[model samples]
Target: MQQTIAAPQRDLRPLLALVATAAIGVFAWLAVSTEFGHSLAAYDPAVTTWTVRMRHGLVTAVAWPLTHLGGTLGLTLLTLAVCALLLLRGRREHALVLAGAMIGSSSLTVLLKLVFARSRPAASLLLGEPASSWAFPSGHAFNTGVFAGVLAGFVLFSTTAPARKVLAAAAACAAIVLVGLSRIYLAYHWLTDVLAGWSIALAWLCVVGVIVLTVRRRPRMLPAGGGPRAPAAGSGRPRDQA
Candidate 1:
């Protein structure tokens, strides 16, 4: 006779929820401080000044394209393209998740901008045309961060190749960092503003992930007999599989 034991299952919902809560708290604090016209972080000016001083023709050339890519029009178009591709491939869940992220992030960004009414760094702006909207939380950073996170999550969850996962993770990280940096380098936003955007995106993604996982684990409806629907022949799975 051979002895056998099943591995214990671990639930990650609690951990994910905790992270989401913490990130939300951080963004709220930043928003409140900005609304009151007080600087929460002492280094905001120092970082902004350093980035302004470091701007050059070469880097500005690079940052210009990146800034546009992470802008409102660019991100909106990119999101629509990606969702269409996912839908065409029959990945309905993935498409829905990406769409929700885009809508949620955009709505929250607009609401916060209106409520906080923080002004952009007018004197430090390097663009040919100045940004006229409120800019406490950089929209470019928020949208790009959320989009990169969704892409990374899809790759990690759907792919089995370790090398591919590594590449995906690296690409996602690079996108987030470069986009955020472009905002700062162009002097359109403060460093703290970028931080708040990233924090909110993290919280939003975690919440969406939790909801999807919960729905996926929900048990199916019972048959008319009410005992349990039998598993298909040769399937060998439990009849009550969620």
Candidate 2:
């Protein structure tokens, strides 16, 4: 006789917990590393040179609009709007995951900037002046990475259609890269700052992805004979299983 196969039940709570823990650990490590600080300082010159090159005439004009369009306010608002739509569509779990990714990355950016207290470039900025805070990690870059990476992860793992998923992934990557480039082009941050931002954001996102995958791979409850077990008393059917 043939045996019946059932889908696996994922426990996302563990993955979320793991991502949160790893995020905190990485942040703490970065905070305490004097060597990382020096390393970040060394990467500044290359970033500055690239920024100058990209800000010349036409490039500056084009990048100005693109960069401004992808600003923190714009990205945040866009993310929130999309998240609302996702939640309405019964994707609350994904929305929450994305939101966590955004909040975690942004919080770390602010905290690290405060701790480092590194100064922004003294030379004239290509696009605008810096006033908000010190430079060590680029908030723009970090936010871009977190937002884009998380969005990409959701699309890649959750979407059924291959074409749409690929397109979404491409778009997410483009957005992240452009935002990082914009920071350098606008001279708002050192190359080192942007690099550090990218690294931390990517690392955090990787941790998130790993957790999500771990949860997705968990075994579902099944009958001893190997089929989906009936729900006990009040446990309704697994709601979309994320």
Candidate 3:
């Protein structure tokens, strides 16, 4: 009888890279097309309707606070604080991957905004003055999408339990959708802008996810007998596993 050892699965990094590249191509095409312009023009009526609807009711009041809460720098700092905790808890690889995803996605959004030079919605429904920026891709939508998607990916990939994975995925979906809605309600971005932002952000997130999976699939060698142990609790050697 022959003995067999199961081979580890191949990494999904290449697949993610391919998806990310494809998404970029699609976003580039949309940015350059007259259709995107036409779409923006066509959406004005709908935007007005939605904006008015959002300005009233208890739901609007509730969503208002939560949406702006996510938009604040303090919330961003809190997220970073959590990432720091993950690193301290020996999840440095996950932390680095998430950090890269957030930073890289943000850079791409900025570059696209400058390159497209798209304008924001004419109407300002929100309490304060509107932001000044090229607005084809809504930054709030993009950032929220990337943050939620990457966090979900990390949770799904790292956790062994199925229920937790489902919860994380649900949370991600809710966050992305809510953020996109908030942008439209506030009249900060056109509908097409939010859609484009979401499409591109999701595509980039999938790419990053593939990369993470690919990295995780590779075999790592440990020293004989698990090598020297950490001298203190939570003081294990930090390796670039991801």
Candidate 4:
């Protein structure tokens, strides 16, 4: 029964990979357009103004810490802690994957920033100064998107209970959305920047995930062209395996 359920999923991985590749290409073109003065994302300033206007003391209080939580230092600590927990729980593969994903996210952010060299908003409403980073894609939003998606994928794959899966998915989504909102509300990023961050993260995660799962499921072959090993004589009949 499990094989019946899983086979179709395996078959769909190539399709997923293709979709992810196409998304990455589209986003790359969008980024290039923004960088070369083609300026496809003209609404960025208006969205920034709107968010600034809607800000309040109470909301700022909430958004202030939320933004930090999605920042590099904060997310770094969280990722290390989660990696430790995963190791202690004997989930080495999961820990490695999570750490790799975060490292990739951070590296990608830096590379994109350098390539685009896009400037941040003129000012940050919260700090009264612009953040000292290139801002076409919000690093906070990008990092949080990857973090949320990886954790949610782990939970979904590890659990069989419907309610648990739903809860895990919801929590991950909430975290991603709140972090993105905090960036916009604090005037740290334009709406288009945050959207681009999320779009790229989603595309990257989907491609990496499909590749990892497919590779992990490949059947191991015996050396020297040997066939499947026979069951031990006293164990059981070979036909009983099925």
Candidate 5:
């Protein structure tokens, strides 16, 4: 009975991957077609007032440092740390998946940035801080989405414990949200850029996650309900009481 239920759930994994792929396709279409340009431009700078406060020092006290975690080098190190943890846990395959997903997402962001060739917010709006990167999908948002996503996936599915899953999920979601918010507050990314980043990152994560789960699934010899199994006849087994 457990196998019967689990089989269907396993089958649905591929379909979920397909859905994520479709989302990526839609985002790419909108990007090339410029369908989101107007809204992106209009919304991009609307938060300038909030970020351009005179006490910018207060903002820099922690947010700027925290945002670096999404940067290429920072995220690379963090991914390695998680992979190491997974390795120590004897989940070598999951470690590989997590590493591949993160590294692949980072590379994708770099390539996409070049392909889009969209300029970052103008220097004037950046409060005199220099930001010299092409921005369509924010790297911070993309990397954070992927990293946090994989962690949450692990917490939710890799364990039998429910309380840990809920706690980890909440914490992971909050941290990822802060990463995106930090990007915007620093005048480093437009709203739509972060949205697109998240969209694509999630799509890719679903793909990687499904592939990993499929590859790592172990064969089970028993049903979900725990039950006793009688031993085969043997030479020395005692007969039933007469």
Candidate 6:
């Protein structure tokens, strides 16, 4: 009995670490984001000033697509497509986990926006960016972080090829960074809003990821006698060698 519990504890060490890290991130964001009516990441109007000032043709072109990709239709299609692919590959549970992670992040983003009711920067502050809604947490940054985190989890666990893993990780990380930066630069969200989004989604992924791992790693229950199941007659396999 003790051994059974011990085994699960060992298997859950990774999850414990992830949870600890996420707790710290959540606490830090909540502390910083709710202080004195502005967050450390967006304490200065100059931060927005400089970001708006950096707008140009090439950067705008690159940022437009990324923001769109993290948009409503784009994010929905991307999530469905990835979930569909995972289902096709017979990794049904992983597919579900992936879908749930992204969906949950998206849902929470909307809920938090409603709760905080933090308005975006003034229209006059906008250079070429769009800000037509609440801005406590950038939905794009939050959803993109979950997408990247879940995709990276799948890649790291499902594939063994070093090059493929590296490529996928790089792509996932790049997408997340670009999406967050786009939100900030486009003036769609404050810098702290993006940071809070990232923090929230990251904490969410770690939690969901732990649940999935726990389910997957559950050890098979043994027989009542505390031993492997005996093989059927004539099977020719040792019963104790399970």
Candidate of highest lDDT:
1
Task: Tally clashes: model 6.
Answer: 0
**Model 1: ten consecutive residues of lowest lDDT:** 1-10
Model 1 lDDT, full chain set: 0.84
Where is the poorest 10-residue window by lDDT in model 3?
1-10
Off by over 4 Å in 3: 1-7, 14-22, 25-29, 32-36, 39-41, 72-75, 217-242
Q: On residues 121-186, what C-alpha lDDT tens digit does candidate 2 reach at each position?
A: 765654676557877777887788888888777777763799989998899878878787877777
Clashing residue pairs found in predicted model 5: none
**Per-residue lDDT of model 4, residues 41-114, tens digit only:** 77777877888888788988999889989999999999999999999999999999899989999999999888
Q: Write one digit per residue (lDDT tens) for candidate 6, span 1-242.
A: 42242243446548656774976577466645654555575464677788888789899889889998987788999989988988999979878887888778878878888888877776776646455668878889889888888888778776479888888889988998899888778777777777777777777777886777677677766545676456689999865644
After the best TM-score superposition of candidate 3, give how far the Cα of residue 67 lies from its true spot, in angstroms. Answer: 3.3
Assess each prediction's global lDDT (C-alpha) against the native.
0.84, 0.72, 0.73, 0.81, 0.75, 0.77
Better of 1 and 3 by lDDT: 1
Evaluated at residue 203, the lDDT of candidate 3 is 88
How does model 3 score by TM-score? 0.76
List the candidate 1 regions with Cα displacement exceeding 4 Å.
Answer: 1-10, 32-40, 222-242
RMSD (Å) of each candidate, 1 decimal: 6.6, 8.2, 8.9, 4.8, 5.6, 4.3
Q: After best superposition, candidate 3 residue 220: deviation in angstroms?
A: 4.5
Candidate 1 local lDDT, residue 201: 85
Per-model TM-score, in order, reads: 0.84, 0.70, 0.76, 0.84, 0.79, 0.80
Worst 10 residues of 4 by lDDT: 1-10
Residue pairs clashing, model 3: 11-214, 12-214
lDDT, candidate 3, residue 71? 61
